[model samples]
Target: MSASSGTTAHAPSRAPWLWIAALALLVIMTRLWMSSAVSWDQNEQLVWSQRLRLGYGPQPPLYTWLQWAVNLVLGPTTLAVGLVKNSLIALTFVFMLLAARQVLPERTAWLATAGLAWLPGIGWQLLRDQTHTVMLTCAIACTWWLVLRHIRSPRPLGFVWIGLAVAWGVLSKYSFVLVAVALLAAALTVPAPRRALLSRGFWLAPLVTVVLVSPHAWWVLEHWDKASGSTLDKLHPADTPSRLHGLATGSGDLLAFLLLAVLPWLLMATYTLGKFWKAPAAPAASADSKHTSSLPWVEPLLRHYAIVVVGALALMVLAGASKFDGRWIQPLLLMAPLWALSRWPQAGNNARGARRYLTACLTILVLMCAIAMLAPLRDAQRGNGDRLNWQLDAIAASLRNAGFDGHGVILAEHHTTGGVLHMLFPQAKVVVCDADDPGFHLGCAWRKAERARAKGLPLLQVSTETPAPDAWWWAAWPIGSMPECQIHNLPYRWTDPAQAQMQLEFIVYPADTSAPVSAPVAARPTLHASAHSHLQ
Candidate 1:
């Protein structure tokens, strides 16, 4: 019998509820461990918490608002945020399993959910709240809903759903534009969906998204030239680590990282693909006309999703041509766990291949979760200096004790430190504005790049190799790329020996008379979240 016939004709003896329950239980446990578990993120979350804007300058306010709400209700403790983040992650997996069930077997759906829960990205999101996970989950859910609608009707509502999903995804993170692009263009990949282009609902979605995102739109309107443009400049070949080299770095990590995220989903998705890709040679004698033994109409939907997955990857490669972060590809990562879970095991009722893979994946996850859970392990990880670049707390404390209020604006040689300090003091206006660059150096820092100039006067540039002196010398400040002498140095005393270990720490106290006063004025900018449909 054809796969299409399987859906409509007779209900199989397969035990679906049990499989779904197993998936749900695992997802719950996995999320509980992952959340309240992560202590850090690159810097985006810090910016939002510090500034507390209607929308963020670069990122949309959706994730920020969502997180901010959680923080408000639960208190802004990392543990609190982690809990909510973890819960949202679990929800995403739940929906992913639902999506998997529509096409794959019970066994395959379980496998996909397992793959997704164990995906490293999902783990990271669980450990800490990532806007991408929240937003992308919505986008995928929207996709699932839209496809279901399309299956039932060629109505414009399907397109409207696509538009709204894209808009909301964009609201969560700027990167979601790629998904929107892919979704809008999905019709071209599959012949059946082309009819959606003509639907009134399809056109209406963009309009609704725009209306919803107008507040943020105005923010971008005012500051894109000032802030967003600067960020884009950093992606140029010259500003960042070598483009190819950077991509390769992320890709290597991605290869292993994404395997966990998407591989399972891929397996699950394939179950559906396999079913319809090569179904019955002719209509089954026992099947109804609506339920054909021939290829089910559902084949196109699977193919459409496949095209979306592949198309999104192609776009990422193009985006990565400049620079990439593993997190950047997160929107599409949901598919892996789904596909991975859906593969039917070759063995008997014993469940071999899928079960074995699931077990192996879960075992690795347990080790990782263990490593993350142990208090000693976390403390060790934080100060280990193997992963983190420097200990900002120690450095900040030293400056504060040395008569600095922890309120002064920071000028750093590298933008990362500037970014760090910005997080350190949300109340202060930390600007790369010294060089007209607006106070940061690269990556997210340059989002306000147009404002920075090369003002060659250097900040306190601490070398990575040298053990920092107890007293920061006025001589440590450099006139050029390398400091002629160490100037304005300060010493730090740690209660624990663990804190004394040194790493690279550069504090640029820009030589400005009004540094203190100017910071507060600059910190006044509000959040800007844009959701526009005009894609060039």
Candidate 2:
């Protein structure tokens, strides 16, 4: 519901710089001190950074391009890549504050800003990984703020920004298509905003957005399999659930997830509301103020927020995508605290409630940072590790010690292994041999390796398993044409002692013209037991 237009703006009761500064420091320190191993998403970005393009395997290129650019200046270390994500998160927090300020006073605005620390999706996902979805969260925050501003002020530039933000959001992740639809629907549903739909300003921003995103759109059209295939894999309907059952339960399950996600904030909001209800109500408005009441019953800002979230849930149900990642809906909740504060006017102004909100937010941040630091150490002690825990430098050195002259291609059956090799050995073309799996295939690299084979370059097949007679490589080259191959069992140990180890071996296939390089004859590396590891 809309607030009275005649409501006078009060002076902000507090400054927000301290909250911003604290958040900045927390982001910086966590990225610096957290585990050295990159998460799955971060590792993918590192691989994507090696070859910059407008589109990559089954996703848009904006986030990967951003990482590549950031890594250029910061170096491709775990900290530098994480800083790009942290910076986006910091920007999202600022944008959230700005959006809140439009509908809320400075004190409530600060509360909403700090409340971001409570969203696990924001805290854990944004802090831990620099993925396309994280970038989409930042884009969504910026878009919503612009959309709200445009609803209030009807500025041409606001629409342009809304258009740009939506375009960027979609380019970051395809799911943002839902966000763009929700914003447009919100604008059309409300009469004041509906009027602008016919205006030139309304069309200008979308036109600019179309112009900007046209190149990427062309790339998507050309690479339809990559663009759409990834989405299908995630949303693929399960046969076991039965279509009717999935449809029946999807929306309720989604709504329940949303409720549980915000339970902590809801509790605090309820307490503030309780205190507001007990306190004396404000005096009745003057009769003259009736004419100043806002149009469309609901504030367009709140209307847009509700519409976006509900619309997403509705879409999910209709599509029968019963399963969803909780973090996917993070962008919709950016203004949740602001919306709550607006609903209970007293909560926005209550000094005690404001203090408690800040304190709670700070406490959560501290606890999360401590957990982030300790979790990896605990994982190490337990002999657990993620894919990123491997010793890439050592592996590269070991490969050099064997017959690899740094002139051939290194092909691995797993994306995890290939991604690390690509990052470590920039000179060699690292190819993922498992092209049969659509999700892991890098078409360009696979083709490049084939071309390299035609030129008689050495090919090293690296795998965790021993070479079998009937592997994909065997099919690629005829038995008579195949180069002389030597099996070298090298123990690839984890750099972190707390992490487990594996027996990774390299199958060296020398070029037809070249002599067989001597293997590690006397020095057999010690291998550790293969322990379980989690992927991010």
Candidate 3:
């Protein structure tokens, strides 16, 4: 009772929390609005939005749903989606603070919230507006909410939050398994919460989660082989994010995620390790009930936070035995900070105590945000805002330049290039290059068929978008009688069918390009195969 009263005495300061939260929100809103003008994932997002299905060719549905919601509310713009996603990310700080407050004082909570507001990876992801990051953030918040609920009141309702958490985790991204695993570990670790499993509530969570995910599962079944292969390729990563860089990536990601949360995380991590090391004693196994003399209101929460940290992390590593990218482990980052701060030792003086721990985090967070938003600074940084697609322009120019009277068909294997071409040159008809997806190949076929209906003549395919990567085509030209082909084998397996590439070199079948030129047009400017490799 004395411990509870003492913790109540150290209740968080509303003033500083409000000030920091407001500033953090301001920064969030600014970054979000700034990102609205152009989209990094615009092409994929546009496709997903229009298609409107449970699953996509590669990505999960979270970003699409987010994009759809943003478009519905503010109407469509690249910037608007960016802002919305960023705002949602920034809002997660409230969750962090609430979670922290259960373990730390109000002041510490605010500081932690402030730190999280601009934590590098978290802030960066919010601005980027990708599905993986947002889904992970939602999953983390759900986890925190469930943990606190169980600690405060372990019941069937508490278990219901767990199920909801899993549902959102799945809907957001298939990686919700990691979040579920963390929750399971959290439920088991805390003594008060252990009863959760014995009740009907435990299995109810998984059952509800499975029911919610049935549609996506069906979608996967519909495109079984392709989906499985793509997912596998993504997990194992053909391009080498092999575990070493993966570890550094995860560590760096943690630092970034923890950057803006507060000094308490810094203090707690330092305090625990420094004390545990310098003092050199095993933390009491029964420290939860007795620790109130030293720790705060919900010391159990802190202990659970540690279990969540390690458990979620172990699950992440096991999963990453197949996948990488720091963002995928986002939920882990969020939970880790909460765990770190919750363990923060109580110092007699709150002001000096918080200042010493939180100063670096807050300072760096604000400073980096300013640097990121600075126009010149952003441009100078690699992977910052300046990157643009020259490939789109090149593809558009080739088609436009090829046409004698500016009337011809432009086809592409994907809608990305077609959409880019449409945006770049609205007058030209852009069609999907795929032979299989008729809707994709329809535009060019419709244009050519219309022309033929008016005056019968064979259509000509203007240019293929296969120049740069297929540079080895010269060696493989007349690609017949090759040893690999003779064995009915292949070299450098490309993901798509040959119909996927623009292979027609003036052949009648795929729509020939080299018909006789009209008079006054000099010899059709022949493309040197060698120059094809120079494409940037």
Identify the leading candidate in terms of lDDT: 2
Better of 2 and 3 by lDDT: 2
Q: In model 1, what lDDT does residue 199 have? A: 50
User: Would you list the rank order by TM-score, best first?
Assistant: 2, 3, 1
Per-model C-alpha RMSD? 11.4, 5.9, 10.5
Model 1 residue 209 CA deviation (Å) reads 2.0
Candidate 2 accuracy as TM-score: 0.81
lDDT of 1: 0.46
- Model 2 pairs in collision: none
* Model 2, runs deviating above 4 Å: 1-15, 195-200, 238-241, 271-300, 403-408, 435-446, 455-460, 464-499, 508-536
User: Could you estimate the TM-score for every candidate?
Assistant: 0.59, 0.81, 0.63
Instruction: Give Cα distance to truth, residue 194, candidate 3, Å.
Output: 1.0
How far out, in Å, is residue 521 in model 1?
Answer: 25
| lDDT for each candidate structure | 0.46, 0.63, 0.48
Error of 3 at 479 (Å): 19
Quote the lDDT for 467 in model 1. 32
lDDT (tens digit, per residue) of candidate 2 on 30-61? 75665455656776677678667778877778
The model with the greater lDDT, 1 or 2, is: 2
